[model samples]
Target chain A: MRILVVDDMVTMRKIIKTQLTKLGYTDITEADDGTTAVEAIKIAVSSGQPYDLIISDWNMPNMSGLDLLKAIKSTAEIANTPFLMVTAEAEQKSIIEAIKSGVSNYIVKPFTPDTLQEKIKKIIPNPVK
Target chain B: MPIKVPKTLHPFINAVEKTFKILCFLDVTPGDPIIKNHKVSDKSISGIVGMVGSKYIGSFVISFTAECILNIVQKMLGEKYTEVNDAVSDTVAEITNIVFGNAKKELADMNITLEMAIPYTIRGNNHIITHKTDGPYVVIPFSSSLGTFTIEMGMEPKKKDRRG
Candidate 1:
C-alpha cells in the first residue's frame, strides 16, 4: 500500500498525491526530483518499509524519471516494484525507451482520475475495495 | 516527397485549446500555423520539452510573452501577479506540461506513442532554435483573450540509420 510519487513541480506533485489519496492509497510519499526519489527509495528498502509502487515524472533536475526507473529496476531488493511513468512527453521513441527500461505502465499528462484509477488497477496487486 | 503530417496534430490542437481554457481561462481559436521566414525571439517566456519517437526527433516549444504569462498566472492562481515570481514561473512550466501531456494521449489513439522529456523554460529575447536535420517543422498559432501564443514543433521523422 506504500507508494512514492516524484515530480519537480509542486502543484503537479500535489495534484497527483490528491488523486492517489482519493483512490484510497494512504501510505504515500513525495519526492521533488529523481535524486531525492532514489535516495528515498533506498532508505525505504533498508528500513524495511519499501514502497509498493513508484509513479514518477520524466523531466527533473539531477536525475530524470527514466534514470530513476532504471536505478530501481537494477537494484535487487526493489527491482520488481511496480513503476509507472507519468509524463508529458508522448513521442514514440520515449515510449519505446520506457518499455525497454521495464516500466509497469505509462500515463500521459492531464489525465483524469478515472484513467489513473484504471491504470493503477492493472498494475497494483489488489483492489482497495 | 510530400512529408506525411502525423494524424496526431488534430488531437494535439484540441488538447491545447482545452488547456488554455482550463488553465488560462481564455477562449482560444486555432489559426494557421506559420513557419516564420525570419528568426523569432528565442528569449521569450517559453516552455520546451524534447520529443523522441520512431518517426520524429525534435523539440516542442510553447511560446508566450511576458504579459501573456503574467495574465495566465494571475488567472490560474486566482490572484493578481504583476510580475513573474517563482510561483508564476512554476505555473508556466506546469501549464506546458499539461498541454503536452494531454496531446500525448490523443496521439496514442492513432498508435503514435510519445514520452515527455523534462519541461524547461527559456528566458530572454531573440533566442534562435535551429534544426540541422531535414524534418518538417510545424508552428501552430493560437489566439486568446489574454494574447497570442505559439506552439512550435521542430520534429523530423527519425531516420533509420540514426540511433534513437
Candidate 2:
C-alpha cells in the first residue's frame, strides 16, 4: 500500500515512517507540511496510484492538518482515502473538528507502535501486511 | 508586583514522564523542582513553547545537555548521533510539543485552558530563555539512564480576569 506521512518536523516524520515500516509497510512517502502533502496527493492521483492512506500531523507551518483533511474530503477523487491524524493537540475541540471534517482516526503523539497498529487496523481492515 | 505561580505543575511533570516512557522507551524520574534561575550549561539545547490562556500566560521549556540529547535521540532512532543536528533539534521540538499538548489537557481539567503554539528549538552553550511571565520559572529536572534534562514552567495570572 502506498502511504503518505505528513509532518513539519523531520524527526517526527522519521519516527512515523519507522513505525509504519515496522508494521510491514514498505511503500511509504513523506511530506514536510500540508502544502507539500496536498501536492504529493494530487500528483499521486494524477499518476493513477493515489495513496492508500494519509497520516498527517495537526499543527504545521504552511497549512494545518485540519485544513488538509478538509481539502482532501472536498476533492472528489481523493475524498475516499482514509485519513489518520497524528497530533499533540488532544483538546476536545480539536478532536471534534477533525471528526466533523472526516478524519478516519485520531491519535495523540508519543503513542506506541501497538497503538498505531490498532488505529490503522480500524481504518484499513486488512492494511497491506 | 508579586507573581502567583500555579497551584500545580503536575501536568507538565506527568506529560514529560509519559512522553519519555512511550516515545524513547526509557524510564525517567523527576528530580525535585527549583524556582527561578536554573543554570543551563554550555553545549545545551532547549525547546521552548509559549502558552496563553484566559486566566494566565507563560511558557514551557525543556532543556538538555548536548551529550544527553544526542544519547536519547540515538536510542530513540536506533542510530548513532555524535553531535546535535537538525534531526536532534527537531526531536526536541516535537517532544516539547507533545509534552505541552498532554499537559494542556490535564491543566484544562483544573480550569486552566491553554492555547497551542509551535515549539522553538535553541541550541548553543548557555542559550537564554525568556518566558512570558515576569517572575518564578519553576524548573523540574528529570534523570534517565541516558542522561539528565530539565523542564521549566512559568505562568502568571492575567491582570484582568476574562471568562472564556
Measured by lDDT, the strongest candidate is: 2
Write down the worst ten-residue block by lDDT for model 2 chain B.
B1-10
Top candidate, metric TM-score? 2
- What DockQ class does candidate 1 belong to? acceptable
lDDT, residue B63, model 1: 80
Cα RMSD for candidate 2? 2.9
lDDT of each: 0.74, 0.87
Per-residue error for B95 in candidate 2, Å, reads 0.7
lDDT of 2 by residue, A1-129 (tens): 999999999888888989988888999999998988888999999999999999999988769999999999998988898999998977898899999999999999889888999999999988875
Reference-based TM-score of each model: 0.68, 0.94
Query: What TM-score does the first chain of candidate 2 have?
Result: 0.96
Which ranges of candidate 2 are over 4 A from the true structure? B1-6, B38-43, B162-164
Residue-level lDDT of model 2, residues B1-164, one tens digit each, is 43433465898888989998898888999877677754343448999999988888888999998778988898888777888888889899999999999999988889899888999989888787867877667777788899989888878778786435
